[model samples]
Target: MVCVFSFFITSCEQNETIEAPQTTTKVAKKRLFKAAKAAVSKSKRTPSTSNNNHAAKRIASIDCFAYVFPITIKNGEEETVINSKEELADYYDAVEIGSEPEIVFPITIKLEDNSEETITNLEELDDVYDSCMGEETPCYTLNYPLSLVQEDFTTNTSNETVINSEIELHTFIDMAFDKDENAHITFKYPLELTLSDGSISTIENDDDFDAIDSYCYNYDDCEDYDEFDCFEVQFPIKANLNGEEITINSNDDLEEYISKLEDYTFPDFVFPIDIKYTDDTLVTLNSLEELEDAFDDCFYEEDDDTICFDITYPINLVKNEDTENTVTVNNDQEFDAYLDSLIEDDYLYIGYPLTVILQDGTKKTIADDDEFIALEESCDN
Candidate 1:
């Protein structure tokens, strides 16, 4: 509804103009005036995404997000972000968009402390109009820069003695924004660290910019997005922390950093509030685009059970946190029976199993029903 009205208004304003009332043409002029006003007024009104044409499309193929503990906010200052907010990802919680700005969402995050401040920055037609308003285009004036107000926060363990504990603060918001421009961003979690111990801490000082918006930028696109000064307002998540503003093209780098975080043992943790996963299933493969889809889509996390991913389905997994104790895909009764039933001469072996010792690379053995030979590793020593 908002996009349609915006398209009508911007189109009429540019092409047709409402002139002064002539003597004889009062009625015709009045109708035109009313239409022009209606268009403009409708354009100015808030867009109801519910009535959008692309709602079904969005539901069909959507982006997802998940937040996990010990999150590191890697973008901000030497400081890190900490979210005890152990959020289980529902399919809807992550973002979904279809067709373009029709179902677009430009997200801005409001911190726990700064709920009072009104979003004066990205809260207008022009804020969204300029980018979205292309002639003969959709003219989707998405309520530029959507905002996320902090609903509430709770600490796992109170800050009496400074002992650390996991904390997960829940935040949710319905937004409207341009389809492009960080519409679905994987925030490098901004987490705070305790100097004394390595335990996750939430003892935060909300003194800095109370609110953080991703689209908080001036109309003018700057050449050097290197420094914070390039933008009008500071974003919730900051890029170019240590690396020389060398922007990462994909979330692969983010996943690499997240995966190898334990190796580096980073000082601070920043939770950008945008974590996502590709699938909700257990047997999932990690891909470049899919890693960015990581929103920790774990169905649930229990205080007692530490098994991170889904454990309901029987899988080839290790027990007691030991990879050595693995559940290999061994030949069961059916498979063994099938193999035994095969004729001895009919069966073919690609390579010698016992002679050809196992190498470092991919080592899968194939055997024929020849002399019953037991295979042993040559490099056992």
Candidate 2:
């Protein structure tokens, strides 16, 4: 019996030892599986490394001219890409090793007397008056029977010969005058003068020559005189539409001018009318609202108390997206109301890319918001 009890106790001890190791092995395996699952979950929640590096990938730059989309510049090569102006500047600054010289346009001047002179540089125009001082017809005394041609279409135009000074010439060049258009000249400096009554004149520079030119150009009744109180020209006022030149003085003439543009289809955002001012200034009206506003400023009513000068002109309209969409508005209240309806219906907005030939003859493209506002302010002035 003693042997039996000892054997039973040994058996019990062996079983407990074997079971202890089994339990420990199962617990360790469970812990290892849980750790592995937790590691996998944490990895899944972490953001991708590729997403973090997205901004670093955008190293290329782009430039946009006249708000016409952008072209990318990568390693001195032009590429097509959409990029902000600031980004383009940054990329250019980083990669550019040297500066390139600016290219200048060659200019030629044509006088009314069929005398032609080519000016290869801006310096040549500086001493024109001094060079012609002792000649039979001095440059200083010559009227604007002058037309300028430049390799750049922006600066080619018929200008007033009154631009005698270097500063004036530079300013005129900067204005980017349109080709084949009449520009009114207003003097900014006083001229030593004698009136028709043989008395010394009190007329100074900075005076507008519009009234004087109006009488001289529109009427053939101007009297023969050596020099008048203001500047005047007897030349016909003309504008180049495409390649064809048209004479314009009245609303009918302007309508005939617009009739020539009926076959072309422009973008919906574009204002189709090309305006050539009396001063040879060029402006593209982008909206009917702007056209109406300009017209409002141009005309006046005649009453018994005042004589209102006629300033009416025909304005082209964009009615549809077709070539035949061209229509003319000539001081018609119904047409104005129709434009207002279009605006109210959200078919038209007050914004479009405006390319203005500034007073200094430089071409400025106003497409951004700030530029548009500045243009509006200038129009108000």
Candidate 3:
């Protein structure tokens, strides 16, 4: 109902003097208006692109998981057995437009984690899809010089604006619909964007943009085992990768091992591995279930504070300004734990000229207390 009303408003606006580009078809104009509405709604909720349509299509296709061999699929009255990824792709290619393929229930699927799940119905399949997608992470940064098509209700004119920075982009979006909600902004297509997978996509149309929207940028593409987050797995761990026994000695080794895995497969970790938390506390995970349980709460300390900088490790912390009782902190997790463990009367100070990593990943050395206070204020800005 809401979509119908939004589409009607866009149609009515186009009937006025608001001029679309000469090359844009009427259907294209409507799609652009819809994209504009989506952008406005998503920015209001969170600063990211909307991907509801794209996600639905991906969920239907089971992009992240593999169908177990010998599963049945029906296209109208025709039934067939799909044995491999190649056969499934062929089936999709040959499926008739009107006759959508339907899955034969009580089928099994292989997830990315090498776990097999029995999906009895569409609802169960949806649950598995949600689990496979995992959590939403930070989006990739939009490149500057991006364009937006702005609509002016008062003048009945549509003009394109080029945005050069993140700040300008936010300001323009905020002001675009200030006068009237119907007057919205849409993106000028044929734009180049960097996806979460580090691939460049030429978003030539609304459909192209929608397909890449709200995509979680994976720095390492390690869906379940993210190294940048809270806990660090004590290395020299054993795992079975593609029916081969291998020892992963470090994070690099783990990455190398994962790179060698076949599609829709993951390393089967040999149990009884140790992990160290942010608080510098070590714990042993005896099984995969325990490891998953550990990751359930393994968010980084910066998530709580929204800080813009990372402090360099191995900094000296003095308790109550006593140099004799100074403690050396190696990471953000340990520092956070130390701060939390402090009593009401206890005060802690860092031994300065401390080094810190800024938001842009540059290192800076703070020589005194005044400089540190200034740095904190800078983060607030």
Top candidate when judged by lDDT against the true structure: 3
> Residues 7-43, candidate 2, lDDT per residue (tens digit)?
2111111112111110121122221122222210110
Judged by whole-model lDDT over C-alpha atoms, candidate 3 comes out at 0.50
lDDT of 1: 0.22
Could you say which candidate leads in TM-score?
3
Tens-place lDDT per residue, model 3, 280-348, is: 999998976566445433422222254556667788777655789788877655654555455323445
My TM-score estimates for the predictions, one after another, are: 0.14, 0.17, 0.28
Candidate 1 wrongly placed segments (more than 4 Å): 1-381
Better of 1 and 3 by lDDT: 3
Q: After superposition, how far is residue 348 of candidate 1 from its true place, in Å?
A: 35
- Please identify model 2 stretches exceeding 4 Å from their true place: 1-126, 129-167, 170-175, 178-381
Model 1 Cα shift for residue 236 (angstroms): 23
Clashes in candidate 2: how many?
11
Number of clashing residue pairs in every model?
42, 11, 2
